[model samples]
Target: MGWKAAEKLIRHWKVLRGDNVKKHIKQGPGHEGGIFTVEAPFHASNFQVLDPVTGKPCKIGVKYLEDGTKVRVSRGIGASGSIIPRPEILKMRTTPRPTVAGPKDTPMNLVLEKTYEPKSGKGMPELINILNDVANGLGSSTNL
Candidate 1:
């Protein structure tokens, strides 16, 4: 009995722009990583726009057929045979690159110029020392 609802959903469903607009296509429910073609539902008809001049799957690309109008060329190819499509995005959905916070002076720098490279060439500091130093620096001389 949801005929009206179904019709409304179909009418409002946005057209899949192209492979460029989509990040991933569901390969299959059982497929590994669930990624495949950039196109959704992977339909051949959606990519059937042929170039008007050369006419073999439009390798020449979508062009103005004696009439001027702009459109995305097939495979991102252009009038000049230029490979216009940007190369597939490498490292898709990767975690943000760790920020290289340029040359920041840490809290330890307030007492010593460098934290990692100790003046005494000491190894890692004890947690108690760290707590004591931090407390003393915060205007407290009490030992932890």
Candidate 2:
């Protein structure tokens, strides 16, 4: 690789490796300095996803199965013919959904309860009364 290419590769490697360095800006804060970790935007080319079945480096490709489900597959040279399972990190949700209802959660019966009448364009009288009470409480608090 040429100097520019090598430099670019090194920069990418540094970012991926989480290389930390003490940097000082000549323009601002000339003397005061601390270790500043590099931010992301690491190139995808810097790493390769290994094939799960063969344990070999391979390029990914999208393929549809007979069941009409689309999945990632190894396609490039020396690729293993196996369906790549999605990484657990990718499958994970930032906030996982609760499997069981909590005490604060509204009961299914309450959620399914018919509260509105399409024919009269009016909500159930009980809900209206509860809403009015809540509004009154807010108004009283603000007045205080």
Q: Which candidate number maximizes lDDT?
A: 2
* lDDT by residue for model 2 (34-61), tens: 5555454556564568898888898888
Clashing pairs in 1: 51-58
Residue runs of model 2 more than 4 Å from their true location after superposition: 1-14, 18-41, 92-144
RMSD of each: 18.6, 14.2
Candidate 1 least-lDDT 10 residues: 78-87
| Candidate number of the best TM-score | 2
What does candidate 1's lDDT look like per residue over 1-144, in tens digits?
Answer: 499977765654445545555465446576655434353443334444444444445432444534675444555343334233423583265587655544664454566754464576465576547676886795354543
